[model samples]
Target: MRAITFVPGKQGTLGITDVPEPEPGAGDLLVQGLALGICGTDRELISGEYGWPREDPMILGHESLGRVLQVPEGSAYSPGDLVVGVVRRPDPEPCGACARGEFDMCRNGEYTERGIKERDGYGSERWTVEAAYAVKLDPGLGTLGVLVEPASVVAKAWEHIERIGSRAWFEPRTVLVTGAGPIGLLAALLAHQRGLEVHVLDRAADGLKPALVADLGATYHAASDLKAVGFKPDIILECTGAGPLVFDAMLNTAAAGIVCLAGVSSGGRLLSADAGQINRDIVLENDVVFGTVNANLRHYRAAADALSQADAAWLERLITRRLPLDRAPEAFDRGQDVKVVIELGE
Candidate 1:
């Protein structure tokens, strides 16, 4: 089978190569790979900036969509079902969080993730996943189901946001989503689904991004400064790891507001921030700033539900480009696209 492989920490090692076909163990599902979504994490892995160091090249895709080719008897899924494999698996020690099926919040940082960490990912012509970790999607989703994985991340973020907001009388009416990328757009989608007034901020002054946000019945601001957003947002989903923008979001939210940090920032850059004022604002306003990454089964399921209920046309627009497996490496090139997907099947 042809698969996208990369040697972790080795720059210029990403390519298409032949690998043994996946063999499913008991209680596993053999799936025919359909599509693979490319994100910043994939680019980091290809650039040798992130991922566990391994001598041999490992398959390199986590955002996956496929149709089940075979399933164990009595499995909840069946052959021909559309499914997406969960990325993170429980750690060996199974930390308190992982033991509770919250490996996304692995306390010891020992958890293994498919297509990441020490395990082989699903960026192949075919793949196998334990039935428990395979999320069955609506057949109607087709290739768009590749979005479940990223959506799951924001689902977990919203889940945590609500949990924190529950401490007070939380009826948030306005939300500001920083960055108009996949995560930010999906974050806005989920917020819109909840009936919140959504506003998205990005650097692009004119592009499909601003148009997409407008189609959602939400407002879009194409400005680097958050001050242009005008009113203080009741909730802020900061999807751009830009240092200055992150701090701007912290101080720009309404009183008792919650800010969800869902973007991973590349280090080595320093900024002079007013720590005292930032701390004072949070303490005085009782605001919360939290970071979330990855997703467990619960979030994946929530993501599937959200995708299923979303406007199909809108969801389709998120995928701006699709390439064949042989051209998978090209998908990593940064472009003015919301999502880039690699088609694994002919």
Candidate 2:
């Protein structure tokens, strides 16, 4: 089997290599990779800025959609079924959250994340996952199901937002999503599905992103334009990790607004901010800012359901480029790509 392998903490070590096939244990399902979505985290790993992988030479993909090649007897999935393997797994010494099936909220810092942390990911020709962690997708979803993993991240964020918003008379009508990447765009999709007025702010106004935002029947604005005539959003999904934008989202939201920080920042860019005013705004407005990352089985199921209801054409447009396994390196190039997928052979 050919897989994309990298030595974590070693910059410029990513490449395509041949590896042995995955052997499934009892209650496991063997899946052949169909498509793997590349994101910022993969770029970070390639640049040696992210956390070290559990395995020295690690495969690098978390957003994966595949076809089951073999399944254990009595498993929910069957051979030839479309499925996605859940990424995060509980630690050996499980925390209270992990024991209760909330591994995404694991109290301990020892959880293993496939492709990101202590496990080999789904960036290979074939992989094995326990049946419990394999999520079956609607066949109609096809390759678009690769978006499910990132969608799951936003699903969990929305779940937490509603939980926090319920403290007051929460009838949110407007939403502002910062950044127009897959995560931000998907967040906007979920908000649109909920009948909220969606506004997306991105740097690019002429690329596939702005066009996609327009196709959603939502408003799109550049950051400069948004700053000039701002709308206080009821919910702010901060999908850009740029420090200034994160601060702006916290400072410029509606009263009783909920802001979810879904993007991870790279440090060292300093911006002067008025600490007192930021604190005052939060205290007086009863605002909430929370950060969410990774997803559990529940979110995966919710993401699958959301994809099932989404416009298939819109979902297809999110994938800006597709490359064969050999051209995987080109997929990491950050040149105007919305979502890049490496299509593996069956």
Candidate 3:
């Protein structure tokens, strides 16, 4: 089998490599890879900035869609089912949260994240996962199903937003998503589907990002003048790791607002900020700002439903390019496309 892999902490080490095909164990599903979605995290991993691979030649993918080739007896899924493998696995010594199957909220820093930490990922022709971690997808999704893992991140963020917003008398009607990347765009999709007034902020004004935002019937801002959007947004989902925008999103949200930071920032870029005023705003307005990453099984299921309900044509536009396994490295290039996918197998 051919797989995209990288040696963690080594710059310029990512590429394709031959690896043995995995066999399904009892209670496992052997899935033939169909597509893999690329993102900033993959770039960071290739540049030796974000991942913690336990060994050399670690398979480099987490966002994936596959079709089952084999399934264990008594499983809910059958062979030929389209599925997505969940990325995080609990630690050997499970933390309180992991013990409750909330590995996404692991208190201990010992969890293994597929493609990002410790374990091998799904960037291969085939891989095997425990049946419990495989999420079934709608067959109608086809290549569009590749977006589900990233969509799950959006799903979990909204789940937490609604959960935290319930702390007060909350009825949010407007949302601002900072960054028009896959995560941010998907976040906008969910917000629009919920009938909230959605506004997307990105640096691009006339390219694919803005067009996709418009296709969603949501507002697009170049992020040059966020204040020009008129009123403060009731909810803000920050998917850009740029330091200034992170703080700006927090400072500009509405009263009683909830801000979700879903982007991981690479440090060393400095920006002057008024921590005192930020504190004052949160304190006075009872605002909530939280960071979310990865996802649980429930989030994957929610993401599948969200993708199914989305306008198929609108969802298709978000996919900018699709390449094969040998050209997997190309997916990492930061092009104008909203999403890049590696089509691995039939």
Candidate 4:
């Protein structure tokens, strides 16, 4: 099968090449790739920063939407079903935390997280995986629901925000989302659905225009001047992964407000979030700070539900560009791309 892969044996180089198709293991589902997304992590994996197997051929794509080509006869999902799966392929332990229905804490695990390890990924003509990892989308949901995985990531933050928040669903309050990256825009969209007065901040106004068109969130701003304007919010989610800005949001959140840190750094640089600063600025201020990672299965369901409820107009905004696998590199080049989908075998 043809794929764009990172072929570094150790501390090494990046390139695209052909590779063998995957063999779905026990409880596995074989899926044909329909569309895949290029994520920042993929870029880092290319540079060998995200810890790709130092001595193996690494397949790097984790975001995708597709259809089941085959599965065991009684696999609980039908072949030809539309699906979207997560980035993580966790280890299995039936008697452990996940089997007790606690998937997030599952221990004895193997991450067949393709494009990052020995496992082949979805950025190819075909992919095979554990049927348990597959998530079937309702036929009623369509293409946008096909995007449920990433969107659910945003929804998870909202679920957490709503949980920690004192504001009732009936009461309207503002939320300030910093950064207009895909994650940030998605956060804004979720906040909009919750009926919060939403403010989106982004330096590239054009970059945020699509989000504006969806009316996913109202008001865009230069990334600069966020602090000077006093756009205090009951909740703020820092999706840019800029630690300094995270601290800014922490300081600015209204009393009893919540903040979610949703981004991952690429350059491998560290920032200081002083303990005294946390005690004096956030804790003393009675703010909630949550460092959230990937969502569990429930967030996936909620994200699907939200996608199902959303209008067609919104999905169109999210799918900014659809490129063939060969053109995938351009998707990562900086400037003028919100979310780029690689249409596999198109």
lDDT leader? 1
Better of 2 and 4 by TM-score: 2
Question: What TM-score would every model get versus the actual structure?
Answer: 0.99, 0.97, 0.97, 0.86
Candidate 4 segments exceeding 4 Å error: 8-13, 92-101, 105-112, 166-172, 206-214, 266-278
For every model shown, the clashing-pair count is 1, 0, 0, 8
lDDT of model 3 at position 113: 82
**Structure candidate 4, residue pairs in collision:** 27-131, 28-130, 28-131, 29-129, 59-115, 60-115, 91-109, 91-110
**103-169 in candidate 4: lDDT tens per residue?**
5445665433556555656677687766666677877775565477678788878877777764443
Q: For candidate 1, write residues 299-333 as lDDT tens digits.
A: 99999999999999999999999999999988999
- Per-residue lDDT tens digits for candidate 3, residues 54-154, read 45689989998999998888999998999999999999999999999999999988999888888889999999999999899999988788999999999
157-198, model 2: which lDDT tens digit per residue?
999999999998999999999899999999999999999999
Q: Listing every candidate in turn, what is its Cα RMSD in Å to the true structure after a full C-alpha superposition? A: 0.8, 1.3, 1.2, 3.3
Q: How do these models rank on lDDT, best leading?
A: 1, 2, 3, 4
Segments of candidate 1 deviating more than 4 angstroms: none
lDDT, model 3, position 220: 92
- The residue pairs found clashing in candidate 1 are 115-121
Point to the candidate with the largest TM-score. Answer: 1
Candidate 1 local accuracy as lDDT?
A: 0.94
